[model samples]
Target: MEPGARAVPATLHTLRKNIDSIPQGVQSVVEQFSVPRQQIISDLNNVSHSIGFTIHSLLKEQVYSVLEAIQGRAQDLQNSLHHLQILHKTVRTLTHFQDELGLALRDRKESTVSLLDSPHCTSCARALGKAQSLEPGADYSRVPSVEQVLKTLSGLPKANFPDLIDQGNSTFNSMPDLAVAKMAQVVQDLKDEVNKVSKKVQSIADSFPVSDYTQPLNDALMQAENKSRPYLQEVKHYEKYRWIVGIVLCSVVLLVVACNLLGLSLGACGLAMREDPSDYESRGEAGAKFLLVGVGFSFLFSWLLILLVFATFLVGGNVQTLVCKNWANQEIYKFIDTPGNLPPSTNLTQLLNLKRTLNLTSAYQECKKGAGLWDVLQLRDAYDLEDHLHLSQYTRDFQKRLDNFNLHFEEIHFLDGAGRRDLETFRQSGIDQLDYPMFQAEMQNPVVRTSLEDLARDLEGLRKIQRNITIAGRLANESQALWKIQNATVLTQEALVVKLNESVQFLSAMAPHLQLLLKQTMAEIALIETMLPVQAQRLLRHEIGCFTRKELGYFSQYLNWVRRTLTEDVASCQPLATALDNGRVILCDRIAEPWLYCLRGDLSLPHPPRYSSQAIGRGLRHLQDSDSR
Candidate 1:
């Protein structure tokens, strides 16, 4: 261990300590080399002898070891460099993050200060200043102080840092609550004012003169109340009137029942008298007269009872008529005259116009004389007269009469050979000229024209039929006369046959005695026929031959019978014509009777009876008895 050698050992010792300080796995490899220095030199000599290695190998080994050491040192330095690079990158990222956070904080602080100091913010601050200026004693608690409001608003941004905008909205929401509280306070104040007003009103009401209105109000209320009870009582009175009418009806019925009973008893007595006529005679003239008188009385009484009923009916009818007339004059007529309080001239004009326009001759005539004004006005009011005034009752009645007269005239014209022409004239003149305006205005209305036109057509048809009947009657009379002549001819033929039979029997009885005479008469007839000149004889023979042929021969016998039958027929036919003439006269009389009666208004036929004064008197007496009963 001289100086150099000692340095080597000291280097080796430091090397060994360095190798030992290496990681465990690397220390193990180093420990293997640390066995013995002598063994290490020997093994190196053996390797050198066995391979015959030179100094170059030694130098190569040394160079390889040095390269390995250098490579290891390079790897350790690279690892340390990588760790330092990672550390530098982490420090740079942390510095950059710190700078970004500081910039954001500074920007937020600057924005807060700038926004709070803006002009809009100043306006809000001024509002707060005004609130703060409020008097301390004048409900300042209700009106927020301006300084306190600004402080509260300003604190919002700091207190709710993360939700400053949201807190601003919250402050706005709080204003609604404040408004509600203000409204409530105002409402309470209004209620207090209303209460004060009510008290003042009550005091004024107490000061008013109550006595002045009290008596009049009480009187008015009492009058209204009193009228209510009377109105109810009037209704009750109307109901009582119905009962009173019923009682009167019952009394009348009772009287009628008594009258009927008396009549029946009287009728029974009359029947007994008639059955005992012989007994009445045996009882002497007095009894017979008494029975007769009783029978007469019964008849008179029955007639009287019937008359009484008739009189009662007449009285009732008259009473109903009067009542209807009164009602018409009051309710109907008065209303028509003053319809909705219209002018009287308007009503009168309407009435006259309706009468004229409806073609009601009777009503029109009455209107002309101002007599039908009431009736026409009544109808005008009842119906929508100005709009639909056709065929009111009076007008309808007049039209009915005019229609009947027209029908009768039409029948007469047709019977007199003017049917088609008259019908054409009526259609063209009368029907066509009818007030069609009334129909056009109300075409859909069923009652407007359909019924009237149908009735007119039907009446015209009836007139045509009546005319046809008249022609049929004349034809029927001619036919009947012809039939009678034919019948008479047949009867006369029968009589002629009987007479011819009688003549034949008489001739046959004389046949035996008159045979030679008959032959001589025949020879004479033949010579007389030849004795005349040719033309003369021929003429004579012709005349005789016709006479004999017609009168005697078998053919002549037929001729004679026909001639006799014709003679008898002519004679009978003559009488039939007379009878037919008489029948025609009688038929004419029958037809004319009704027509004449109708014309004269003489209702005295079987259809209309005439009562004697005695009968009338009896009837009156019976009515008196019935009424008394």
Candidate 2:
């Protein structure tokens, strides 16, 4: 071969040694921008995928969280709205009830006069009068009527209606005749009002749904659950189906073991059959015949060996001998003795010659009297010992370090020594923190050139200056504009309230009709008074025509009923009003929460739980301090 040329190394040191050195300025001119350019390209290549991937995952996780919050809040809002609507309907029904009651009251004058003339009303009034005079719980021989019902329901003590103050007739002297008569009309009015209210309640219930709000709430919660469930299910189902797959795999392993055992048995049988030369063909026979002979012989011998090994000594047998020739049959045999023929001839010839009642058979047959697998048995006993020891660490270097640490720990077992070691450990750990993942990044995150708190004085000055600058001044102008708008809105609300008061006054001014023939009833005057109208003052002076105890009692009962109805209506509507108010407050608070949190720099939405990595040295120090305590 011809002599070959040698190539020098192209590495940095080799290159510098071989090539001439350039001056500093020339070098900078040659590679300054080029090296940075290459570095930029390399950084872009290395960081682009990581940055994009990280951002994508972060965005997806944040989006899911946002969606979950939205769905959950939507459900809350839906429930609030639904309940508000239901309450609104209830209020509307109550208003309708009030309207119907007003109509009933308007038409009751004629009905009142007729009911006052009824016999039942007179009887009830007389009973009530009698009751007022008699001891409590005393029985009177009178049938019950509407007056007794009212007297029973009134819950008042020793009060009498005007009907009981009869002046013209002696027969009606024991009764509050006028009041009892008027009560029948009141009863009819009550029934009509209850019926109308019932129908309204039923219609409202039918129009609104029982499950509409509940179903939406459930769906919203379910949607939140589903945000994480779909992907999580892929992982969760792995545990579920894993059990099934494990079962299948276990079955396959068992089958393989069984097949292996069977193959071993077949091979052993073939070897066993070869011990019998008579079963084989002649040496001059064809190769096919040998194979046929071998297979046939294997099957025959395997069956025979199995029969003897398993069936003969089935009591305590080791049939493993059938598979491996090296193993011996280990079966226990039970034997029963029989007299010899020689002994029979000498002393028990009669017994030997006599017919036996039971003919005893082989030990295996006598024990079971059944047909099954064959086997035999042989036994041996032995024992062995074992040592169970494992290395604490796999690699020599790690094990050496572990052992050294153990020795170091032993030497520093005392409190003072241990504390000194702890400090040293902490010093080492502090150095280790420099290599901790994201340590520098985490440190950089909480640091700033100028924190908001530190820049407070500067911020004030900037604010004032920004008020004059064109760009930042817009924000100041907008803020002022918003304040102006809010003030205007307050003024507008006050104006609206003033207009409402004026409207009420206008309505009150138009209350009395300019007709002399038509006189307004006290009830009409009373009804209008609740409207907060100024004209209601006329009710005090209205001619009710010679007011008596009976008339006064009648007015009290009516007013009591009206007062009770109004009380119940107001009571029932309070929760609805409260709920609506709370909903409004919650909406405002929720709207303001982010803004307030942003201004304070304290917003922290809930994310999935994770293990937070603390500084190694800090954690160690904390643990040590806690242990010392």
Candidate 3:
């Protein structure tokens, strides 16, 4: 039992080793499902990020820039077109003035007045200068169709793609955290089970049949032994006298036997030698005398031998029946345990200085009945071995170690309200609403339908119709001024058209992919919303929880088995009782029974020596008679 107590801690250590592996088991189970789900969530986040990137590309690089560029260029075209209209009107009016100048000059003297001095030519020059000085205004009336296009583009709604992508990524990332929390719960529950099992084992260990009474009882027995020294010495002294009396009693019979055997030998030798019976020195005469002496000795010691045998029989029989029998059956302990049966100094209770009444008979009977020595010795009030087992300490340490297991994890997010809102906003962003075909058609169109340079050339042709030198010169100058304005407007509008065309081509190419990306991103969001939680739940319940329960089951079984074995099997004291029975056999059957049989034989054998002596006397006389012949 002491060895078993020592082994308990090591056994608990072994249990601890098994418990420590639970986290690894949980992780293995968690990984079976979590890894794949995590990968899917990651893929969804990538899809969301891609959608944001595509949206940004379409809005910033394709749609917004293109529309803004188109609006700016359309405004330029309107201004240029309006300026050309004003220039044409101004040029037409100048042409009319020039024509009137030519008509008036023809009617007037050819060299009578200077060309610069002519009122019509002077008026035309002033009008042309004013037309050239005219700053272009943004006239929507000149290009009503383009103004409508700009308004439509400007009215398009904006979407927050970056925020949507972040929301989706955060939502997917939080799944791993939830899974870890579930795993932590598994570990903690398993630890709780481990602690419970440890406590159970400790409880069983405490229940082991151990007591502290043995020590005090042993001390009492030792004191009794010390007190018994003088009595044991007195018995040893009496045993020496007993050996002397036994030898003296055996010698009386041996003396008679020696005389008988010698007489017989002498008588036989005399007969063989044919000795004369009358001769005093003859062997026959000596044989007769020796036989008579043997008879005399036998007659003299018969009653003494009877008395010794009778005494030995009475003493041995009484001791065997009273002492050995009682000792064998453990009944002698009763006699010794009676009050005043022994000296007070030899009393077990007095020696132990204990308040509880001590009973030697009861203690011995209890021991013979296979009660634990501690309980038989009556040490319950003196000490509690149960308190010394320290089972709670083992369980406490086990529980403390159990606390070390936990599932490792990083932060993750499930979709929150903000994320859902962002996703909805992304879904509803009106990318599909924009008319790609219309934008494409508009970009494909030139900034102006009619060439301003052609208009300027048409104005230059007006000089041919004018015969007056001043009128033709004024028309040529006006045409050159209109040509300069057209050149600048055309260059700026052409650059805007080139940028707009690139943007339109990009948007046109991305349109189908953008729609597909949006659909795919939405599908991924739905998958995360519907599938991730279920997978996590299954992992926590089926895999991790099952594994935890299995480990706990094994742990409980071990503790219960230990408890059962200790309580039922280890508690039996049958072996001790068997040993005590063997001791009884050794004392009563082997030792006392043989001594009683020997006493019986001594009583039955006394007359044989007397009879043998008489027969020897008869033999001796017959030998004398034969020798005389």
RMSD of each: 84.0, 56.3, 20.0
- The residue pairs that clash in candidate 1, if any, are 128-146, 131-146, 132-146, 549-556
Report the CA-based lDDT of candidate 1 relative to the real structure.
0.33
TM-score of 1: 0.18
lDDT of 2 by residue, 421-493 (tens): 3222322222211222232122233211222222223223333644235423432343343234324432333
lDDT (tens digit, per residue) of candidate 1 on 146-219: 23222222212112222322332343234324323433433343334333433332332233222232234335
How well is each residue in 503-619 modelled by candidate 3, as lDDT tens digits?
445544544555455455445545544654454344333443343343334444444443333223333223434444554554556555665777666344445434465666576
lDDT of each: 0.33, 0.29, 0.46
Clashes of 3: 4
Q: Cα miss at 444, model 2 (Å)?
A: 99
Candidate 3: segments with Cα more than 4 A from true spot: 1-216, 227-252, 275-281, 299-305, 322-587, 601-629
Q: Estimate each model's TM-score.
A: 0.18, 0.14, 0.39
